[model samples]
Target: MLNEHAKLLALFKQTGEIIGRKKLQKMVYIAKKMNLPFNEKYQLHMFGPYSEELSLRVEEVCQLQFVSEVKEKKGGYQQYRYELSEKGEDFLSMMSFHFPDATGMLEDMNHKSSKFLELVSTVLYFEELPKKEVAEKVFKLKAKQNYSEADLDEAYAYINRLHQVAPKKGAYS
Candidate 1:
């Protein structure tokens, strides 16, 4: 089985671009919420669900030359983007043999916008919200997404199922 670091490299490989750190974090968090076998533990943070372990793994991958980090000034603020290095691609290729489903999962997630991931992840983080209240809270938190009640309902149904099946403790740690 691929370890969490290897799984992250596979995600970078699947994305095939320099993904923003926040996007990466949210993607992993969503994957975990979806019961995709990621082992990271997440808690609500300023930007929504955040994981220190994921951040540490990113740094580790950078140090290992499996991934490269680039800093860019976007909207006059510095942001980091991560991409798979040649070594990382090679590692991902090897890992694919052991975990074929990972590519498909990453591909599905890569198609979602960061904002959408954030919306779903935030809702999942607060799964206890009453069914009727979910849309209100989600709209308040992510008004820019323009999500409808129907959207929140669908997401809630899906995430709720995954949350029920997902391991209670860290799966990867």
Candidate 2:
């Protein structure tokens, strides 16, 4: 099994772009829900589903110069964006063979907006709900986000498609 840092590095490599902390958290949570062996514990937090383990791993990688963190001013507040450093990229390339499914999952998530990822991850977090009930349940759970039934449907569809293609291999399968 790959370590959390390796999984995060693979994410950066697959995306090939800078990612915000919240987006990175959601992406990893989604991958976990899909049974990609991320092994991070997720809980509902300020943004939706959050993984503190992943956050710490990101910090470690930054400290190791495996990833670069840039502080950017957005709307008068500072936002940290992360991208894999050259060393991180080299490490990810070396470790890629051990995590083919994880790499594929990250590739699937590439180009998705944070909002979309948040909605989908939130929906998947409540996976016990019946298919027909998912939209209603997500609508209620994310009331502050004002997600409509249509939005729920779209997010559910995306999650469902991902599962169909990826087909998680463990207990969730």
Candidate 3:
């Protein structure tokens, strides 16, 4: 029943801790974009791609004591930090599941800033659109972000690097 949840747990197991709700969302979205085993549905929100299902799943894991959520006040807003709990480690140890080898991918993303990941995920979201069109859409939709052409170029490069390293179409036991 916790097959998907276990995958999320394994993500935490690999990356020490994720420090923002948006970061967590973007990381998973980017993984899904790379054709990883994530099954969440996402829509473009104010922060780029957002997923309510993933949010609820994270909440469920927190409620089950398999993960921990810590709320911190960040000036006018709040930020959340997530990590796998001891119980979570125990649960994962007992579950038998296999996912692609995404360790390097996850580590690379885990070290990135949410703003960068936001741009990367946004670019991936509009990937089907022409390059210029994607640029226009990003500038229009995320005007407040102040992303420049150079940033877009960097995001594309990052996406390409990720693609080069993405796991082949197969499951890992």
Top candidate on TM-score is 3
RMSD of each: 4.5, 2.9, 1.5
lDDT preference between candidates 1 and 3, better one: 3
lDDT of each structure?
0.73, 0.77, 0.92
Residues 1-173 of candidate 2 have per-residue lDDT tens digits of 34667877866777666557777888878877777657878888867899877788888999989999998889978888888899987777777355544556576686688888988988887788786687776666777888877887888789878887764477432
Please give the lDDT score at residue 31 for candidate 2.
Answer: 76
In order of TM-score, best first, we have 3, 2, 1
Clashes of each: 1, 0, 0
Q: What is the per-residue lDDT of model 1 for residues 31-77, given as tens digits with 9 covering 90 to 100?
A: 77665667888887767799998899889999988998988898978
Better of 2 and 3 by lDDT: 3
Rank by lDDT, descending? 3, 2, 1
Q: Show the colliding residue pairs in model 3.
A: none
Query: Which residue runs of candidate 1 sit more than 4 Å off their true CA positions?
Result: 92-97, 102-105, 139-173
Candidate 3 lDDT over 1-173, as tens digits, reads 68989989988988779999999999999998887888889999999999999999999999999999999999999999999999999999899777666888899999999999999999999999999999999999999999999999999999999999987644432
Model 2 weakest 10-residue run by lDDT: 96-105
